[model samples]
Target chain A: MGGDVIDFYFDFASPYAYLAAGRVDGLSQRVGRPVRWRPILLGAVFKISGGQPNLNKPLQGDYLRLDVPRCARLWEIPLHQPLPSPFPSLAASRAFYWLDQVGGEHSPAALARAVFQAHWAEGRDMALPENVLDVAASLGLERDAVEAGIAQSQVKDRLRAETEAAIARGVFGAPFFFIGHEPFWGADRMDQMEDWLQRGGW
Target chain B: MGGDVIDFYFDFASPYAYLAAGRVDGLSQRVGRPVRWRPILLGAVFKISGGQPNLNKPLQGDYLRLDVPRCARLWEIPLHQPLPSPFPSLAASRAFYWLDQVGGEHSPAALARAVFQAHWAEGRDMALPENVLDVAASLGLERDAVEAGIAQSQVKDRLRAETEAAIARGVFGAPFFFIGHEPFWGADRMDQMEDWLQRGGW
Candidate 1:
């Protein structure tokens, strides 16, 4: 994941993650750089940090609900919350790592976009294993193999190792990016990140 | 506080607050609008929200420590962490509201800048009452009156009420701004806020 690549870490269930997902690739293409899509489980990171998701908070929850749509409108992206939002993202993460092994390098990025759209743009449930396989199949990945891949021990271990590595690297939130050791947090920092990429950091 | 005025909320003890304090006025001037500088105590708001300062968090603390200086350099602002960082901001907040009463419309803004500079730029300990009085004296205010002003029950009550009002308005963090009730959180959202002001909100 080194050598002029943007290590983009995100969780499928995060609305802000989806927002960044929509832009990270285009930004990469514009800069003539490749983006390595690293999907991490925010729940496990939150457990270690003793923090809770914004959807569970009181005043923050309402403001975030409003802000997400505002951001979508401003960025000109389609966004709609799923029926059971704040849902488990493990199935989506497991599918991603499985694709990373069987499918080509670009497959994970394509599948990540579809999964994010399924949960964030189309308002489809991502917690179900069936929904995850449908997203992979649409990307032209085999259906039965993708289904079997989710339950494989190697896929589970890969996701676990990636999340732990993220925690060890001090990544406590979603949509976190590493531009060659300089960490940029939050979707709001996208402009700053682009400036850094173009200007070669300050 | 209404009618095309941007309500800018901040705490003197917050480094991120200092960053926004430096930019909000310039953005307002460029957009041909006014800003009401509302100094708030984040500790009180944290008490209600079950949140703590970033300095206490594990990963967040380290990332913030790096991000603050990076932001400062990028903005080309002079910044130096004061001795006894995270110093008490009561004296500064009380001085602000008192000046808001006795002084003219621009007096509070001038004093807020001085207090922020004293703590964040000049590396002075704002926790000391003397340091706060010195800041007020530099602004041509009566020193003895400013000294006594910090101890007044009414001044303390004003800061408390403003903080509670901020919480009621869904302000959960420092450097929060409102372009006529459209809430924007974080100093990074400064660009979006300016765009909203220029385009008359999306």
Candidate 2:
């Protein structure tokens, strides 16, 4: 069996990504592949791809408003509604890279999960740096270290580079996965991804 | 079981809709629901919804080029690649409405399937009215009647009105389905649609 790590690209601001975050780990375990969680800024990716968020579109925005919650209920994931206005995903994304770089008692994945839950499940506004820090602190991460790490030029640059790299790699949307060289986009595509992984491509 | 016909909104221009066309009948049979096929022009829908075709976008276009064939393989559907440049879906679409109006020995659904197969399975250029008529003729549909029906102002107006109605009903994409009041979009959402039909929503 090929043991290539599945690269999961996501933005915390995306509710679909939040829904996908809950279940990707289980898929990884089932397929016996380690997941590399890569948080990216969709805003940057969109600027290049000339794409807009579903919430910004007309009919699609309406459909997303309905679909997200229904999917949450069906998937049995707890999700709070009406996310913070101008949902701030930047701070959380930066914090993720910082946590990843720090590599301490808490894995970056845990912080990512906690941040997704705090923002999506508990309706916390991730726009505030303190809110992101608060979620990190809840995970026993050093509050000062996290704040410092996120502010560091290296961490900021890491996020910028990663987002650019994601765009370069043709990732235009959240909850995108790369099982080997094959790319699957959207939370709904997980089933197809699993099938591809198991069948080794048809 | 409450008998409600599933409204399937599609555009012949969309490859995803073509893929959905092959399976929707089977789904309808399995769920004990009749399907009302409604073909709308996506070009009009996109104008109102502020949407662009996946093929027009950057990263998404590349991904779709790869994903379409992969999905065809996974679904075991025979699909010909490199679709006709500027795929003439309008002719086939108009012809479909014409066929529906002049219902005789052949069902409109049969014409839809044949048109999809000719365009997608055989890589026939649907831009030509002759090609669309030829497909209809192969299906035992009267050629001259179909040509005359498509030319009628009433048939043109019917297609226009249907496209307008689709937008009013919030159909922004191809292969959109309505199970009662619940709306599901995309060819990939078939499993969810089936589950909703069988489980009567969660």
How large is the C-alpha RMSD of every model relative to the true structure?
2.4, 2.1
Candidate 1's DockQ is 0.57
lDDT string for model 1 (A55-138, tens) is 889877877876787777677778885323767888889999998988564478889999998888888889898998898888
Q: In DockQ terms, which candidate is top?
A: 2
True contacts kept of each: 0.44, 0.52
**iRMS of each prediction in angstroms?**
1.7, 1.5
Best by TM-score: 2
Cα lDDT computed for each candidate against the true fold: 0.84, 0.84
Report the number of backbone clashes for model 1. Answer: 0
Tens-digit lDDT string for candidate 2 (B6-54):
8999988888998899889899899888999988888988888778788
Q: What TM-score against the true fold does each predicted structure earn?
A: 0.93, 0.94
Looking at model 1, give its docking quality level: medium
